[model samples]
Target: MEYYFITGTSKGIGKALTEAILQNDNTYVYGISRNCAVKHARYHHLHFDLSDTTALRNNLHKVFVPLKEAERIVLVNNAGVLGKIDYIGSQATDNFEFVFDVNVIGPAILMNTFLSAYYSQQCPKIILNISSGAGKRPMDGWSAYCASKAALDMLSLTCQKEQELLGTGVKVYSLAPGVVDTAMQAHIREAESDQFSELERFKLLKENKELLDPEAVGKKILQLLKQPQQYSSVLMRVDEI
Candidate 1:
């Protein structure tokens, strides 16, 4: 049997991924979220604010410590925050800190804690960080979101290198799920019109109807996890799939 750990499973891509993975009889999914409404015999739901690194680390250890040896263990760091968008000089310092805490620091601390307890002799482990195109390309009012994702991408790369050095059978990846229809989109679209240039771009895309389904993205993630050699250390975009 294969076991998967995922965060932000209350909604959006995270919820979709958890449901899709649970469809397979051989898979067990452990989901972390602030709230989880889905119930399944194979699903283990954990509730916590991921922005708290120490608490997250402690919770992760408590959860994974009891799992039996398995052939594959997958960790998806999917929880993230897109703080209120504002012009670079106008944005509050607290906004940047909050974004970084959720998107970058939270995942990094989780990975470190998971690795410290994981004995890879039982299975090939993998870490998937759900990044964004905002990390690669700049948008005027998305400074905090972009910067956090960029740091996450680099952190994934650094983790890949570190895993190779340690000779651990663990692979890390940064994946972009494209523009999916989610609550996050609503937040982006609602940002101050003058400060957010991407608003028009997104509006245009929506008008032209260019939004991907979250379930489709989730399915692709499952496929990638099953074929780790094909995706290891790569920044995969849903559009490319």
Candidate 2:
């Protein structure tokens, strides 16, 4: 059976991906998020707060059995935050730390714990971190978000290299989903122009109806997961697929 462990499954691309995975035969999903938005026999909702590392570690027991038993296992670190939108000088220090806690530290902890728990498994194990193009290109007011994704990408790269040297046969990738129509986008569009120089660009994306749907991006992610052999790069862009 194909098993998916996804974070931020309450909404957006994570939720869409969870639902999409469940549509396949013999597929099961373990959704970790604050909200339990979906109810299905194959979908198990594990209430989790990405900001809390202790809680996440404690809850590892709840996911171990499925991870060990599944024929194919996939972990999608999809939870993230944009933090406060403003120049670095004007940004709140607390918000900066909070963003790293959720977007970088949380996923890193999860990855470490997951590897410790199921590194010996013979199944096709995949780790897909939902990264962003912001990680690659410097943004005007997205300092925290950009840094967090860049860290995640580096984490994936390092893990991938480690697995390669160890012959673990696991596929690790930090995938950029491009511009999607989600609450995060809404938050971006609402940012003040003075704080976010590209506020109008984001607003124009919404006004021009140019944002990609979360569901479509979710499907593309699934397609890539199924054929990971074809993907040679650990840093992937959905538009390139």
Candidate 3:
């Protein structure tokens, strides 16, 4: 049997991935999100929000209960938020905290618990941190989003190093799903040109029908989980898959 623990399952790529996993036999999914929109015998939905890190920490022990029956375990930290778009000093200070809370703190908390909870499970373990190109290249008015994702990439690298140092067979990747047609893009396209200088680029991407589908990205992610050893421990970018 194989197991998948995913966040942000209420919508977007997380929801698509969870549904895809349910189609497989002898597979189980432990999904964390604000709402449980999926129903299946093998799918277990855990209620939580990434923006609320306190609740996650308080209930860390409650997760990963079905790991013992699994031959392989995969954790995908997919939940994230794009904070209000504005110039660095023009945006509210709370924007940074809100964005970092979901994009960074929540994933870190979940990664810690998963590593510690299933440390002894002799199985193929992998952690996929859904990152973005914005994390690698700077974009004006995306300060909070870019910073949080950049930190996520660094954090994933650090975790990969620590796992290797300790001889844990866990592989980690900070993957960038380039320009997916998600609600986040809608939010970006709605931003005023004053703050997001290159708002037209995103608008044109939409007008030109260039946004990638979430379902397609979900399939590639599933393939990665199935054959993780074929890729590098710290490799990234779904386009390369």
List per-candidate RMSD values in Å: 1.5, 1.2, 1.1
Better of 1 and 3 by TM-score: 3
Ordered by lDDT, highest first, the candidates read 3, 2, 1
- List model 1 lDDT by residue over 144-201, tens digit each: 9999999999999998898899888689989998898887987887877888866888
TM-score of each: 0.94, 0.97, 0.97
Query: Candidate 1: TM-score?
Result: 0.94
Give lDDT for model 2. 0.89
Model 3 clash pairs are: none
| Clash-forming residue pairs, model 1 | none
Candidate 3 residues lying further than 4 Å off, grouped into runs, are: none
Model 1 alpha-carbon drift over 4 Å, by segment: none
The global C-alpha lDDT for each of the candidates, from Candidate 1 onward, is 0.84, 0.89, 0.90
Candidate 3 lands at a TM-score of 0.97
Error of 2 at 105 (Å): 0.8
Runs in model 2 lying further than 4 Å from the true structure: 66-69
| Candidate 2 lDDT, 45-108, residue by residue in tens | 9998888878877777886563546788888999899989999999878888889989998898
